[model samples]
Target: KSKVSVIETWLRKHRLLYVGATRHPFIHSIRDGSVDVSSFKRWLEQDYIFVRAFVPFVATVLLKAWKESFDATDMDVILSGMASLNDEFAWFNKEASKWGVSLTNVAPQKANLDYCRFLESLMSSEVEYTVAITAFWAIETVYQDSFAHCLEDGSNTPEELRDTCQRWGNDGFGQYCHALQSIAEHHLEKASDDVRKRTEAAVLDVLEYEVAFWNMSQGDT
Candidate 1:
């Protein structure tokens, strides 16, 4: 039998936190078709800010992969992610216009500021590739899982929000996230014990930040 990967083991050990991040009340509301428009607007505005900060962090990871990864395809995967941000920003702008949420006037909430700061912290040259990729994977997977859940069978997700849901919940995004997971696992398998421990900690941190991000969306912060 194949050995369980480091991320798989961590997921099993921290299932509760993982569940909390992906199945938060904010997501539940969307799945149930009871989501508040105000909450959605708030989320749209704040997430745009988060994504803006996310771009540079992803760039840093791409640079790390280019310099440190043994595999050539790793840079391609990271670069594809970076390229998608252009479409992502466009979607955010359209959504903001639809929701009447002026993106220009939206201030970063405490949760968003804290989360962006965390991403900035990871961009330091001192951080190892193993730890950075672990974080990059965790961050994407949380959105992929949470948004995909809203598209699951029997979910009562509203028609108006279906496009938003499909943006991350679609099969293509799922496949992309899986590719990221594979790259993370590959590096993690060879990581030294100290770096592995740091990667595990980074995964946990990502989960906490995701949960807080959803909470901020719901105005629960």
Candidate 2:
């Protein structure tokens, strides 16, 4: 309870992701329900494109679990997440309709493209399992904490978007982040110093990209 895990503690000390998470105006807008429909539509559409690219990154993670030393339970959890993404996609489309945004014609913005490229590079077979999984855990935990914070008792998040916030911020997803943290810490325990360094460096890059992503969402970048 003191910390989500050693990795989470390390990430906290890193502080880069925390800055990225809390500094984004889009996040503040979400907390205050001040985000306009157009901005939300931009995010929803571009994220749909990002998610399309994200699917393969996740698929690569699944392959890593199979080929690496990860257990069956790990695979089960990943597969379950994979299955839910279909529903997540459908949700985006539904939300897009509500806002009159067209996901089909949308393109990934510069920040999103850069992040996707990083994710694609991770698919290289030469990357170690520990490093790959750490990236996974970092990205997921960022979203979990970012959105979950919006649901804090006084968040004042808009009624219409509360469910969207809950998609990642819910208690269930917090447990999921804890599980991912456990996995990342488990691997870090056995990781060589070089791998640990690489993991931390990759996490820094992720944080930067996340900030860029939020900037893009707010049309600031």
| Candidate-wise lDDT, in order | 0.93, 0.80
lDDT of 1 by residue, 1-221 (tens): 98898889999999999999999999999999999998998889899999999999999999999889979899999988988888999999898778777889678999999999999999999999889988999999999999999999999999999999999999988998999999999998888999999999999999999999999999899
Q: Candidate 1, after superposition: displacement of residue 207 in Å?
A: 0.4
Considering summed lDDT, which 10 consecutive residues are worst modelled in model 1? 97-106
Model 2, position 20: C-alpha lDDT score: 68
RMSD of each: 0.7, 2.1
Q: Give the TM-score of candidate 2.
A: 0.93
Clashing pairs for model 1 are none
* Candidate with the greatest TM-score versus the true structure: 1
**Cα-based RMSD of candidate 2:** 2.1
| Segments of candidate 1 deviating more than 4 angstroms | none
